[model samples]
Target: MDVRLGHGGSMFFVRDALRKLTLLSLLFGMAFRAAALVPENVVVLYNSSDPESEEIAQYYRQARGIPEGNLVGLALSQKPQISRDEYNRTIRDPLRKIYEDRQWWELGKNQSGQTLPFVNRRPVLAIIRGVPLKIGGSPLPADFKSDPDDPISKRNEAAVDSELLLLGGLDAPIQGVAPNFYFEGEKRFEDSKLSFMLLISRIDAATVATCKRMIRDAIQIEKTGLWGRAYIDYSNRHQMGTSWLNSIQNECRAQGFATVADRFNQSFPRNYPLSDAALYYGWYDSSVSGPFLNPQFRLRPGSVAIHIHSYSAAQLRDASRNWSAPLLEKGAAATVGNVNEPFLQLTHRLDILNDRLMRGWTWAEASCAALPVSSWQSVALGDPLYRPFHHLDGSGEEIERDRDFRSLVKLARKNSDPGQRLKAIETLAAKQKSGILSEAAGLEALAQGKRGEAQKWFKAALVEYQSADNQIRQYLHLAAIARHAKQTKNAAGILKSGLSRAQSFPNSAALAEWLQIVEPKPKPKPKATSGS
Candidate 1:
């Protein structure tokens, strides 16, 4: 009755099945573990003296489910910038007492059950909500002699969040001159150094509503995964600082991102076509008065943009000229800039920031890790909880839910073998699939001059896909095919249908603009004007 296979063959088949199952299980487990930068791991800090700050913090606490114990409100000045004296008296001293008295976190336990200094139960992120964004350092006494031996003595002012990176140091007159223990190569967070304890980020914008919008955007985009293109702007000067931007291009490629890099000597051009841009990293511009200020330069929702310029965040509420506010106003989900002159060596490193972000770290974690010195000049603006790559290594089941990820994976694998690519296309098409994979396959067919076959695949994409971006892509491609076939009316109709379907898509402006070019308005009848 069971003679289809010999004993040895049956055993072999069973063993092979078990091995594949085990492998898949392991990969899925890894994906699950890498899926999130836990929201509960962040503590929200607010200024008790500022009603606006407290209100914002309360809203975030409820929205994010932060435990009551994690909410720390400090009484302090509401000024945008505070002097060293005010910082010590109103900020540092009180924060230290709260940490010690309230047992904000317990010391980490050693192997033998004794507690260790650096290791602790502290949350990884401290979000400063509603406090002054920057701090000014105290001047050395005039009679004090300059000491070449002590580098810490030469510092003048620092960012408040940067200074607080030394939360574990509780020692008097914390100099903030200590090295960033959590910088690139160091063990992150759990290491017991005072300087490496808590990473700080901020949520701020031109107003409270703007701040809330930024937070909601970060959460929404991370869930769906960021899509579209990346724009990298490199300065022509070849200065050491500007040259680092080149690394972003390489990293974006490795992350399987579509990118447009501008290495031109000039700033971002006034009429640069910045369509579908999801990421932007540029520098050397002193103000936010560049081509990006154009009304049409709206960044895709969930876009992360930053620039390298001293004092670019000097005033976040000044929406016209500062980097932070302008970027936020232009629809960027998150950004970072300096509150003062953070010299090249002290500024956050672009390469490191890019790497950490790609590795699934949240905006706060990446910014803090890349910062060479905090409490001096850097200000992270946006939701600290934003993690752009949280699902990069997610489970296959989760990957199936995202059409963009499927398309990227298909692109990466398509060139490895032509025969395999053909087989995959045929197999996917036979199943009546509608997804980015199908859309990409159709595009490949079109590239090979099989226009009719490509049109079929695109048509399937419009019916079967669920992602708004992929649906728009299918519409655009279908419209292009119609235009190539000399059917101008058909092309215009396709675009109009897409706009009707995806009315609120962030990049729909491109479709609307294209329609104007292809189908201009008809002039009014001469008889109507004359009333004849």
Candidate 2:
């Protein structure tokens, strides 16, 4: 099967099948080229003074089949944040010494007369729970002056993981940010000249148990692939950020991933019916809120949820505080956050991260590629080696084997024509009784301005949907269609019925708000009283 995808003015063909013999050869070639960073190339670092750190490290090593000798322990501060002096003395210097002693890398001088790592044996590092999370209060030398206009250049505080990326080049200045040599690079870490720089990610969360669960979820999900809806919230506050999210939302829809996107000014409201969120990307919130605030809400296992904030990862041990910790507590297997105020331009690009991960890049590789700078604020939390979509290698075997809603949607997208695509999806949805597919078809119709078709699909989806949250979303979609058609009464009726069904649900608040908007009560007559 030859699948053609149209992008801009170009058409790209994806060859999924050929003659049996040729197809077998192609599969072998793809498999040979898909070799990623192996367990042997990873080193697990843990805090020697913290037992939980060692426990998490050992558990991860066993789970990922990493060699036992790869686990390294260092005596480090247990606090979430440490002083610059404490970081250099207890963490940085000690870890560098251990790397040298272990012959992990050989240092050399670059053409610019700066020290660099030319040969590297271990390029991946996993910092476990119990290790200090961020470095605090590192001031530049008094003799060194920085541009007053560039505030980012004057800050020196950093995430411990970010600072460690410069481990191979100790001579590099700590102030401001260092360009990540691997950022947007096509070559794999081991194949690049800057292999000396470590691809670091932390396996830490709000608690030891959550950290362990994250590790387990990553490994398990890699076998089957992460599946479910992608929730993208666009704040419309920044054009660059909004554009990035728009790209991500489009890509998710094209690839048959069920996606719900909010393009409004406000963030997803509290008690929003966000369910089965397998991938979430939103921004500008200081802490976790929205559906995440609902005590019963939890992300799909192995889900990657990221909320861009200056201090998203300021403190990972407190679940109620920043975005990272609370998201982890809510069962997100992987997330990227900033330990401090990383300027918007320097933070991880969510679109790049999603695109890379979908292309089967490891968590560490995707995270590093998305980040434009190192020795800065971002910290990626998850199993560093996790590849959420490793199973979907374009072989078509996985899709055929699973035949699930995600696969069906992917197959339907092979049709480039919008009308044909919707028809294909509707056929598959009916054949499989998939509420997700019905919902996706409705969204596609709505995007094409086919309000009547969209309403039918949404009504079908409402009946097919099993979860109350999903059903409520369908109601909203149907009501919006009715309102757009100037059938206010119809819209009100739909919302009222949905509200009646949603009374016991946490998301009922949204229904009530919509009801007030569509069908407000009339003001009482006061003329008789005035006359008296």
Candidate 3:
């Protein structure tokens, strides 16, 4: 039967006047169907680097329904798993075609290029937790501070920009470079972008706001298959209430599909955390947008597992840390955080095996342990704990106490007993009288270059310094460390401010050293553009 009035098999998706109306008409031919059993075939992803990788490999076989064989190889000849294109093509593609032929709407792929299972089936989640791999195939850019442009961060930024463009401008199929997960969906490639053409039904979870595409549901993914990534899903399907997705309503901008989208009568805004970029093609039914910075990974329907990496309300970290969460959750099977290369290494390995351990059509699996090797090295995670303002000379190395703290972290991984590790952390922590463990942790974190560690310690230390010996020295210590932290304006003001408070205190040497530290690090001039 002809589903639309204008043409054969096609429907209008966007328009200008009714832009405020929640988008409708995506279900021109999509009929709501009951869910079924899990799909056959699966894709495995990895984010591991140790014995646990093999252990996860074993667990998927025994605990999860996957058989001992059928696991394909990734990361050939390289230390880290580089790409998984071959495995997806051979394994996941055939399975997706099965569902597409069946027209499973709920668990099926959406118009905006999102993957959801038939409305009622147990979705196959490709776990990628313990498979550890190197961060990127290419060397990091120079001037790349560890926190700025790492693999996950760069990808996240790419996603934000992609969603912005895709809401009304998803011309390129794939937006940025990403893990190739889509095996069988209609592959659309333009200017190096890739996209999987899928159909999105008009209805979605009540919690998903109206307007725009990118509707998804949060599912609690377990690792009954062992050492795979464990994720907490909060998409349009469920009301996790962790965070709010942004929604912007921009009327008919510039996507070539503007005419095609006129059927829905709603113009999507270019908002991140609000919509997915692939929706401009008019397939997604949900309102949330996707971060499509990388190349569009056009996976076929009913292929391997599909997981969306949205957060619950009040669960986001500071700008740097939280940005990488979605990438790891969706891409890697297992991941970890560290003073260096936190998310990619561990999760990469886990996801690989999770993908490998798929059964042709299996029952549901449970979540895995958060980590096989819980915390690795003892790295103070906050500002006050790591970056303490010691009155040491320029030659100062890390304090011995800090060294012991690191040892305890390593022991957490090695120690079999959870009670013992907790005891050890307590024993080390007992040495400090800084009220809460957070103060010492703040100083230690600062030493490691985390953003807020110093400020936390300063607030704590300020209270104690009224009684400490040589109050001026303590004040100078805070000011000096602030300089290295790149708070030039704050450091200068703090130094000048400290003088007023320390008028009668002895030992002005600390004050002089602080003055020296603040003298450098001037702001650079902006580069001239060609037009200017």
Candidate 4:
């Protein structure tokens, strides 16, 4: 009766993997087109009032080689949130004046020697460094007519980063969230009907140190490439949000990236091992508490993780609290969080975010592409120009170079037939001796109820893994295999070992939580009554 070795459960999952791979192959045929704006087209905006903000701006400019003329200093509040009136005066008016002065971009000349119109020369990207996160909504306009049937229609508030996209139209009385002109299926920036579509993002977090590191991480990863797995977790609250995550996971697969998507209503698993995560999108949680708390867990450089709970950005100074700072402290290069309870609908669109990045949009562009509101609740933190997949042309050739990618391909094909699946497992084992591939083989073995084979593959994956940062996920996976073998004590021991190793690592929040899950105290057996 020990379903621990249940054939039905294991075999069903094998068929599921094959079906997913077939669907993934079909969707992989979508065309990839490049975006219009490049790094040189961006203008960096920094607060002149805050010394740390100014320093971060200078550091970014120097590191990115952004033109000195492209740097724009603004006198604004050091506070994280500002009023609409103050924002209008300090941000809108000043930026409008600067654009009118034609200082942000170089002027083009006509054949007749006349200067080209300002519309032709506006910067497409606005890199707002160290700006306030949110702007309090202004009172409804006198002519503001709201449909009594729709409560969301009266949304007059905005995230500061989101509002800046409409800097040119700030004078107009805006309603709720501004529509994203660069949304998916729309023309790229150059071909769009709109004269301007400025993509805005910020380099900000708890301190200037975190901001500086974010910029550095972005720079490093763009060059080396964001090589790793993709994890998408959704609480399945809003169908729209869940759909976005679903699309992202598919796109990741098309690009030959390994992905694990959780469609459950539960939080991310406490002991869920995440390895070499290049991109992660999960939400509906309020704070930095979950499987992510495993101290051994850290996102790879240039990884962008967004948690869509209201007030997740309320506090960024402490890594223990809000999502943004902890993610940064845990090694994510960039993150977006809500300073206030920005409604679920207003959160960043995962599809748009993923699509833009695939199209060579920079970190700033991709981060802001799906945001529906400005001067409201959300704030983005990281280098504005970090483009993780900028070099990947979606040809799959570049992805094929990574051993893990090759292994994933083999593993995905391991569900065709008994013979074919066996061949795939053998081919993967022969091609590379990597931890990732071994772990994949181990998972496949466990799924087939081959406990001995699973143990061999998992142990092989875990051996000689010196750094906890790189092997935490492997440990967790191995522990999972142990659980399948009815070896709870062994799984607990593996988690404890990972916890010890993670002490010296950057972020180990997930490890301790994982240990708790694997080693939960045994419940006492019920005592029988004397003679019931």
Worst 10 residues of 4 by lDDT: 24-33
Candidate 4 residue runs with Cα over 4 Å from true position = 1-36, 103-122, 125-129, 141-148, 170-172, 185-187, 235-238, 262-265, 269-273, 291-297, 372-376, 393-426, 441-532
The TM-score between candidate 2 and the true structure equals 0.86
Q: What is the C-alpha local distance difference test score of each model?
A: 0.65, 0.78, 0.27, 0.64
Tens digits of per-residue lDDT for model 3 on 1-532? 0112123222122112112121222321223233222222222222234343344434443333443332323332223222233223432343354434443223445564545432422122232223222122234456544433222322211211111111111122221122212121122111112122111111111111210011111111121111111111222332211121111001111100001111112222111111111111211222222322222322111112222222210011221122222222222211222222222221112222122122111211111111111111101000000111111111233443234333333444453354444344334445643322323333334433553644555555455444322244335436546655577778877766665665343333344444545665567999988974
TM-score for each predicted model, relative to the true structure: 0.67, 0.86, 0.26, 0.73
Point to the candidate with the largest lDDT.
2
Judging by TM-score, tell me the better candidate of 2 and 3.
Answer: 2
Between prediction 3 and prediction 4, the one with superior lDDT is 4
Candidate number with the higher TM-score (1 or 4): 4
CA error at residue 408 for candidate 3, angstroms = 24
Cα deviation of 219, candidate 2, in Å: 0.7
lDDT for model 4 comes to 0.64
Give the per-residue lDDT digits (tens) of candidate 1, residues 109-228.
Answer: 334443323333344444555687777766676676655533334566777777776565433233424345456733333332332257677888888887777777787777766765
Lowest summed lDDT over 10 consecutive residues: which window, candidate 3? Answer: 377-386
Candidate 1 stretches with Cα past 4 Å from truth are 1-37, 107-119, 147-153, 170-176, 186-196, 394-406, 413-532
For every candidate structure, what is the RMSD over all alpha carbons to the true structure, in angstroms?
A: 16.2, 9.8, 22.2, 10.7
